[model samples]
Target chain A: MQQNNIAIKVNGLSKNFDISESGKGFSGKLKALFHRKRKIITAVDGIDFEIKRGEFVGYVGENGAGKSTTIKMLTGILVPTSGSAEVNGIIPFKERKKNAAKIGVVFGQRTQLWWDLPVRESFDLLRVIFRVSQSDFNSQMKKLDQVLDLNSLMSMPVRKLSLGQRMRCDIAASLVHNPPVLFLDEPTIGLDVLAKESIRNFLAEINREEGTTIILTTHDMNDIEHLCKRLIILEDGKIVYDGETELLKQKFVHEKVLEVEFHDDGNVIQGIPGVTVIREQGCKKWLTFDNDNYGIGEVIGTIASRYKIKDISVNEPSVESIIRNIYNNRVTLAMPSEKSPTK
Target chain B: MESIKIYIMLFTTSIKARMEYKVSFLFYIFAILSFYAGQFGLLFILLNRFHEIKGWSMGEMVFLYSLQAFAFGFTNLIFSQLVNFDKMIVDGEFDRVLVRPLSPLGQVIFSKFEVSTAAHLIIGFTALYFGSRYANIEWTFYKIILFPVIIMGGVMIAGGIRLMVTAVAFWTLRNRSLVHTVIFSSKEFINYPINIYNVGMQFFLTFIFPIAFINFYPAHFFLDRSGSGLLHPSLEMGTPIVGIIVITVSIFSWKAGVNHYQSTGS
Candidate 1:
């Protein structure tokens, strides 16, 4: 994609909060009321990246890692402390109204629909708020109905719907305006497997068919793995990793484990040229090696030639384990500089 | 114009929603009307015993009380959302407002449409008509024309105080009780004539928050009474202007408050 076609751009974007430190209990609260001890917290610490048009990017981080803060700033709901950001060529905070007309946002924990009003009434109200044309509104509703199964949900009050159903309606509500850019903050946080898959499929269809640039923040590993082609991982308010989802697994997940069992209990396995005999039991031996340097086929072939192997199995690392490794190790991986592709 | 239509649409839907609980809705109106009527009855009994207060008759007192109620009811009806704005901020709903194409203040103003407060208007107009029969003040073109304007001025002043008080929530994140005190306490003081209070309070009510100009000053000017002398008597004539200024300043404060806002977390 051309650089000029970037839909979302961030240049050293940051947000700092002045949090007040309070004491414990009612008396402590009174003391705090009299004398507030304030401290500054850097919620988003100067992160930078660009998302191309039609790109499905999963913005993932643990709780309090500034994922929601970044989405808020990009959508003009919160102003950054320093630096700048633009969505579709408009500075979000400075041109909030104009930017609002061009984007849609949905928070998983909240509902934009009026609680007491029926679902159809809420949609009709949004139609006026967005000033959507009559024909456009009908067409969009029909399209949403097909995927969201909104026909059965049109008359139910929002407060009456289950979590999965509400989330579907909320997603549909955000798209009533047909904004080119969409922000989904934990859109599938509390959904069931089938509900999650349905939302994921709908999001993919929207991105592919209408070319909507989607920025999804989610804690569901399945959501990130299934929906997003690109991934941005934030830790402690900093962008620690930004690359293709598959490339992250490939780069960090270097070693694979091999387990083998022998029929002869007396047989002992020795170290091979490229493999380490990490463990041994009565009839089983475990070996670990770099899959890139020594192929699993070669290691198995060597083991079979040397010992009478009864059974063999290879354990490939998953993306979940790779992320857990990154978190536990806290290794500052070398990030690709701007304008350079990681591949 | 489009914003006004949206406001009407929202108002209709809110009324419809409130009407869903039919028994509670009617009971609310009945209960509130009775409460205000009981309070008025107590005041009437006190006035009957005193016969007149500071040369002001019971009918004149009724005029003042009911006119203020009219203004209060209208302001409370139209700007009810401002009263609950602090709760909206704490609940993270304000961020949703910011994501919409509509102006936040406009949305807040029309977010709710209250029907119960209309009871105040029922009492107000009835009191005005009844008090006119007994007070026997000669009607003039000016008095007839300026009555509604002064009532509108009263509405603006009430709304302005609400806006200013609630705007403090942008920074403090909680101002419901403070707003309640500012609005209800002012209503309490304005129940009697401004001239009944001392100089300091009279000045505070007239110029500081300007609640007096909404009803008392305008009533004083129309009643042709020289109030217990604290300032130039002609200040009463400027209630309309004071109302406009109050609303304009409130809007500016509201704008500054919006800019000062840091939305709560999701």
Candidate 2:
């Protein structure tokens, strides 16, 4: 994507909140009412980034890291204390209604559908709200059905549906207007494997076929790995890292695990350089070696020549571990080559 | 035009949902009837014993009581959501309305319809007509035409007051009891004759809160009696216009409140 093809641009966005942390009790409540001291918290401290059209971006952060605040600012729900953001060429806060018509938002913990109405009725209501033409509504519903598999869940009341089923419907409702931009805040949180897979596939298909620009904030590493090509990581209300997904992994993950099984019960291989034996049993041992320090082939050759090995397997660090390492500030790996192709 | 249709659909859906539980619906109707009937019965016994209080006959007091009751019932029917606005704000449901294309106040006002309150309205109107006949007010075509205008204006004033109270919730999250005091205090003031109060208190009701215009001035005109020798025909007809202005201001305040909503976090 070209830099000038930006569909969403955020500059110097900041949000501060006065949080009162009064303890729980009647006396605590009274103290809060009379308390003179106030503590200020900067939720989003001057974050800046741009998202090009049709790009799938993952926004990752720890709790209280301003991920939700950034999403709210982009979606026109909260006004930033300073700085500016525009979605589809409209200032989100100033032109909230127009911006809302051009963007779709879904928070995982909340449902926009009417609680007492069946899924079909809520869709009808949404169609009216968005002013979707009959032909357009039909086409959108057909596309959503094929992607989300929402046929069986239409007749059920929203409150009666399972979390996964409800999330599918919620996604469909947000897209009733055929918004060009979409914001998903932890859309796959608390979902089972099957449900997560379905959502991931649906999101991928939409971004690919319809050219919908998607900004997803999630704690699920699999969601980031499978859906996003570009990734931004937030920490302490700041953008600590922003680049391609592969680069984020390669830059933060330097170690690879090696699981070795010995033919003899008493066989032990020690004195291996540049590797740590994290775990060991009677005939098996797990060793972690920095890939930057030693090649996998060289390490395996040294180990095999020394001991009679039954089997040896190398494990690249999972995306979850990579992210945890970055957050923990243990070590920084080199950035991957930028020539890597997008899937 | 589309908003009117939406309101009708919302009201119909609320009625259907409320009727789904047959036993509860019947119980609600009975409970409202019994409660209002008991209050009316106590007023009747008091009027019977006093024969007349401060030169106002029993039928005339009933007219005042019925007028206040009718206006209260109409407001309760249409604006019951205002009474529970604090809950809606705290739950973050108001954020949903703000995101929609329609005005947030329009959506919140039409979110729920209290059909059960129509029972009280019907009862109040029945008493008003009977009380008018007993008081021997000369029937005229103009009076008949003006009755609906008075009722609608009364609804607007009461609804406007409720709107103002609900707007405070945008700043203070939980204060429905404060709203109740604002509503009930006005109702209590309007239940008796405005003439019984001193000039200062009467002026406060007429200008500050404006509860007097809701029923008292209109009732004075319809009954063809001056309000303690102070009513003027021109002012009697003009009181409801003040209500229209108050309702308009309330609507503007509601819009300001929507702008000030700071939505809660997940």
Candidate 3:
């Protein structure tokens, strides 16, 4: 029996692409036309996960880590080579149109709206296409306007809007049908800090207040840090880590860094307890200590007593650094449900 | 019915997009109109010089050209975007279309329109009127009734040809060469009566590619020409049936292509 609470479920989902032989020059291309040698590339290896209703999950990976491929399978854009996937309890590839009505998708690099049409006209067309009633359309547009500040940009053609404005409209357009699930592939890519921040906030709000299940994939760690409650990291077409965002950080990163600047030059203080000096350059010093074994005050007091510290600051391992450590270390994180993770 | 409404909405939006550069658009329209008229003028000069080819008069030739032009133009207006199918697959437009609550074919159809085809449409209608006058063809009630139906059938045949070539792009990821040779240059076969060509070439055009259904075979009906010298007499009335079969097969091929699709990388 399929559960009503599950928004998305995937088991052994995979997609393989047949890439045609690419020859070098004119004659080579001509030869490839008739010879027809093909190589198969597995974009998404077998993966399993289930997302509950209203959960905000970040799908993160390196450039070719199958993040976008997984999202494409869920959206019914590409049929998987093997395994099964269900969105809102409907098989997406089999009943694509049915699945489409229940979900909304936005590709950050591509605009779903008509490029040359006015923003309002595009939304209105989408409303009719998605079978959104007039009252519901009105309410959705009103809410989108408040959240995305879309009123000023409605009259302009989509091509005329700046990248930031177009991205905002794309997000607003995705929600016009008020779909219960939204899939975003690299939605924050190539945006400035402020633009990404607004998109991040809007996504977080929509996921929380409207109870919409969102799966976002991005290279920006800040997007994952601020918007996602859960993180699922992919490495070379396989899931490497899947758990709460906080939990992944805690499991992978434990040591914290503290930096101190001494008033006197060339001061590399030694013999500090509970904290080991990791780096020394000029009058500045960096120390590392396990957060679990020593308190922040205890580490700081040990350093200050032995040396005259002019300025001091403590650093917790940021989500970016922690994720970098995971990717670099090639950590094979155990699935939390299968077993408790051990170092 | 709702699909029709959405198509109209998208159609008008397309017109607005073309209206963005009014001066350049008008210039393009003018260029196309004159270019077609000039081609007809050259044909007139050549026919005046040769008098007739295979006993077919200049008027009959012009009429054949006009019918083919109108059918080809209507198909071009509707299905020219199929030529860009590779771009859609590579540039994420197909991905966007698949995720929407609409038929993928319908979405692709409504996404873009070749509005400049109005030039071919206008030239086709006017030349057709004058060519019929020159040919002294009598328009009986049945002939008049069948004229619009024949034209629509002709459009379907040409559209199906374009669609089949486009379907090849799904696996190939590019169809520029096919679009040029099959959808474009192939239409030149019906510019004259098929009987003008040799038996082998005529068989290829009539049975193999079947571009003759687009104009030549059907033109015999309106011209009051007998099928005595043709391959088969019944072929003159083959437009509507040939059209239905070709489009159905092409659509099936297109659907299969979609099923076999592998979208480009992100």
Candidate 4:
């Protein structure tokens, strides 16, 4: 949202994985030791983006689209093969400990907290690791307790908690250091509806109140819709789109759907300008029209004059559809340079 | 200082978790004791049948056996994770250790402490005491003090070797067979006196892997046996220093291995 105050900046970062051509097993391992055949797969191709302080950005991509790889590079868990990335003004891979100290990362598929220890003990251990002062630790814990409702779960062993409960505790554990940047990889994955809602709300509140810059990667479209204003779409190890979330939907979705109910059983609107009948069943008609070419009012007016319309409703394309369109390479959203205002 | 506190906390928590299965924990202790007892019984039977082997008295053999046992027990107790290194790497558990602020080696070494191995230590000490009495060696203060130093050196050498083997797993990804070869071969060398082997074999064992530094060389020096004339006077007097060198090299290798760690798929 702001320039030159970037909390995270990436410049042409990429990673390549060497997969043994012989495949995975004892034979492959032996083959890899000597006279090996290997294939180089690029997990993250060169791509760049910048996120300002206090921005919530959703990094969305399909499976094997390098979302996790990009996150790992950002978090300093994996080194980039080429190019560079900085979080909070420090190069991540070069100054990993410093970067780690300034950021919190949570992978929903895995828990970083000690399994046998109680949630509170795990939090305390994290505090010790991060070297948080006592008063700051307590205040942060209090904030986490209020936001995540962690009191009941704190005393329970982490291994004994349900997935949702563990996830809430994990978020709390990650935040104990009061890290300015937070990386959440599929934080709402495998969560129930209510659990997802609570996590989403807590994340929003923290980003707003604490000004915590967040980079969230999730396959779930709902998380993006609910939490992030900015979205970056990755496909085949490259960024296909990066812009405001609403702009993506507007740019990609060409047609809008209109549902009409006829007052008379036999009444029908055969055709309208820039509109195609999607389906008709039992006096209800679903029509699709190019939003860029025709306004909903003009379409509705034409439909009403042609047929006895009793009720009508219009639906814009959903975020899921827009993402799917990106994944299928059906639409191209404008890049930042292309969207810069003309002189 | 903070890392030490965290390590202690981790150690205590792991012990508590292990104790949660009280029956299994007790059974594990019993099993280890019985295994060591069985080996001791065989040693007793051998000593009863034969007066000595290679000009070495049964009591001296006991000293050698005890030294090896103590060294192996202490190494296994503190670094048992090394024995299971392949499983941790394959399961991606090493990723967890990497994320922690503390050294990954420290976390792994302290992750699990085998309390059951204490039984081996007790049995080894008992055998050493009885053997000393039977050997009827003069109770000089220097000889007495040298015993603990020898045992500590033995532990350090064993730990160093184990750490090196575990470190190899970083590159190899699987080292069970390699570990088995190294451990069993070293055990074969340590089970008997180093003097029994030819000079070249002695040099190989002493200079290369240094399994002899753990028990044979130290035991020979303590008993005033065959190795006294062969080794350099300073090296003979500084066997513990050799152990320390081995340990330092092993740690350096481990650090290098960690630097080369290419973490598995994200």
For each candidate, the alpha-carbon lDDT, in order, equals 0.85, 0.81, 0.85, 0.81
The docking category that best describes candidate 3 is medium
Q: Please say which candidate is ahead in DockQ: 3 or 4.
A: 3
Q: Candidate 1 residues B1-266, lDDT tens each?
A: 98889878877887877777799889978887788788668556644765577677777877777778789989988888888899989999899888988788888888786666767677787777756666666679999898889989899999998899999998789998999899777798887777777889888987897898777877776677775535577777777789899999999998888766777764
lDDT of 3 by residue, B1-266 (tens): 98889877777777777777789889978887787778667556644765577878888877888888889889989997787878888776799899988889887887778876887787688668866987878999999899888888988889988898898989888778878888878877777678878888887887777888877887788998877334576778898888898899999999988888887777
lDDT score, candidate 3, position A131: 90
Residue-wise lDDT of candidate 2 within A1-343, one digit each (tens)? 3544888998999988666566569888788788834678888999889889999999998998999888887877677888988888888777777888888888888898877667887888778767788899999999999889889999888889999999999999999999999999999989999999999999999999999999999999999999999989888888988898987666655678999998886766678888888888888988888777677888999889988899989886777787888788764434443443321
Per-residue lDDT over A60-171 for candidate 3, one digit per residue giving the tens place of the 0 to 100 score: 9888889888988898888899999999999998988999999989999999877877898889888988999999999989998998999999999999998889999999
Candidate 1 residue B52 Cα shift, in angstroms, is: 2.8
Clashes counted in candidate 2 amount to: 0
Query: Candidate 4, after superposition: displacement of residue A122 in Å?
Result: 2.3
Per-residue lDDT of model 4, residues B1-266, tens digit only: 87788887778777876776799889988887888788778567645766687777888878778888888888878888788877777776776666556667888888898887877788688768866766665667898888888878877888888888888987778899988788655776777777778888888888887887777667766676655424764465555787798789899998777655556654
lDDT score of residue A238 within candidate 4: 91
Give me the candidate number with maximum TM-score. 3
- Residue B10 displacement in candidate 1 (angstroms): 1.6
Worst 10 residues of 3 chain B by lDDT: B42-51
